[model samples]
Target: MHALFKHLRQVRDGGQRREYSRYLAQRMGPMIHALMLVGALAYLVAVIAGTLVRHSPLPLWLRLAPLPLLLLIAASTRRVRQPGLLSTLTLLCVALLEIGINLNGADDLHRQSVVLPGLLLPVASSVIWLGRWDFIAAMLLCALGPLPMLLSGNIDSALVFQYLVYMAIAIVLSTVLRAFMARTLFEQFRLERQLREQANTDGLTGLLVRNRFLELARSALAELHRQRQPACMLFVDADRFKQLNDQYGHAAGDAALVALAATLRRQTRAGDLIGRIGGEEFAMLLPGNSLEQGCRRAEQLRLSMHEIRRPDGPLTTSIGVACSQRCRDDIQTLLARADQAMRQAKNTGRDRVVCSPDDC
Candidate 1:
């Protein structure tokens, strides 16, 4: 039961919901068209047969009156790309068929409304309805659609019971099928997300790589510019990282890098972007942060580096902070200023924070 709930939980995420719905709409367009075609044809055949073979007393034209309306609805189904809209149109089609069947039977109360479209529709439609609510709606309509006609005909209680039981079984089978498909699509979406993240992030630290960081940072900065908000960039370097690697080993160096990445991740906001720009070098882009705030953040981050333990010494990093308002608007210029300040920090002392000099 928990697993079933988990499978259905994919739509809980706003992004996943949008993605799944769009995918569902694209896949369901042709399917909806097919279902509409089938429904229209079946209704047409049932109407004609009732008039000719069953001796339905209603005028053939009155009995077949809904055909044009049905065809119009079917034509509209060709381009519908919204799930809710598609469901509404489908339910409309189903209801039209049910009404048509009811009209066919109005001539004689003994006519079986429980047959034809009602018997087959709910179960048949179970496969195409991607949403649980949509499926339930269709099922209820199919199950109860023929009740008035059936009861008016002096139908046996046993037969109604049999129909209800068959409906229950069909619903269960369709529900299982829906659950299976949701699980499959959800898994596919998750795998695709993982692949995309892997491609964009560093293998060891899981921070954005240099190229991905630059690509996203430019967009973030553009938004900041539009908002007229100050932005800050930080260039962080492990002090004496080469010496530590030489003394400790590449494995130890890798561990230190991972630890630094984790610390950066813990300290930053979700909107802040961190990237492993180079070996022993990382960068952060803080949108809407002023120079003072960036400096303070850098100092706090430098102090936090005091916690990560090592054999010879605690981990220490030199962080350079540069504000967009102080530097040129270009990211490259911001990066260069931040890099210069970082070098200044490294030169003045090993582990410290430095804010870039104003470019303006």
Candidate 2:
């Protein structure tokens, strides 16, 4: 029961986890449609068989009662966007079919065998494509499908006991199978996420890698353009970084880089993008900031870097500030200008902020 509730919570929480929800919906939609179509065809064949070979005790209309529901389910599966909704509807359709068959075939012993096997279909479907609440709904409906027959005294006591035992076994098996599949799917999603992070992020600083940072900067620039807002880019290079590396070991250099990354993360807004674009250089994209605002921010960052203490001495950074309002340039061109400004700061002094010449 605890496991069942845990699975239910996972399904309920899936809306917050968009990637997993989308993947589940895409996979389950086709499975539901295919299963409904096959079920409809099999029912059609069964009706023909009953009419030609052995006269069914139930009326033809009674046996065909679930056909329209099956078709409706198939159509709905294609249109429904949420996986939880689709699974619920599919389980309901299966349950309705089970009830209809049991009620229609209550008088015949041979018909009971055929009708009872239909109960397994919902259990199997729920195991393969649904969560705990869905599975429970399917189990309840399928298990109680023969209840009307039992109440009416149509089925013998021995047959009733046997059917109940079969249902118990089916439920247990379905539960186990659902657990295994859910765990495997979760592990696969976790691994894929880790791989994506490794590809996009720097291993040392945990900032965006050079190429990924450029891609994101381009996206941010496009967004700012659409909003008719100004955006700023800051190109930051560590001052006298080679001297620090020469005096200390490479490990000290790595630690300084990591510390710089942490400082940048702390000083920037949540929406800002920070990246390690080179060995001793980093970049930041600040959306909605004009040239004047960008220069102020760059100066603040420069001061913060100077305050960062290292084993050898205090660290300092040279920052170049560029803004979208300064000129009609693409992201790459703006970044190039910012890099040139940073070089100017480097040439004049070791630690300072410089705006683009035109903007200055």
Clashing pairs in 1: none
Residue lDDT tens for model 1, 95-154: 777778777877665445456455677767777876778788877777777777767757
Q: How high is the CA lDDT of each candidate model?
A: 0.82, 0.77
lDDT of 2 by residue, 320-347 (tens): 9888873567889889989999999999
Worst 10-residue lDDT window, candidate 2: 4-13
RMSD of each: 3.9, 4.2
Query: Which residue window of length 10 is worst by lDDT in model 1?
Result: 109-118
Tell me each candidate's TM-score: 0.79, 0.79
Query: After superposing candidate 1, which stretches have Cα over 4 Å from the reference?
Result: 1-6, 9-108, 152-159, 325-333, 357-360
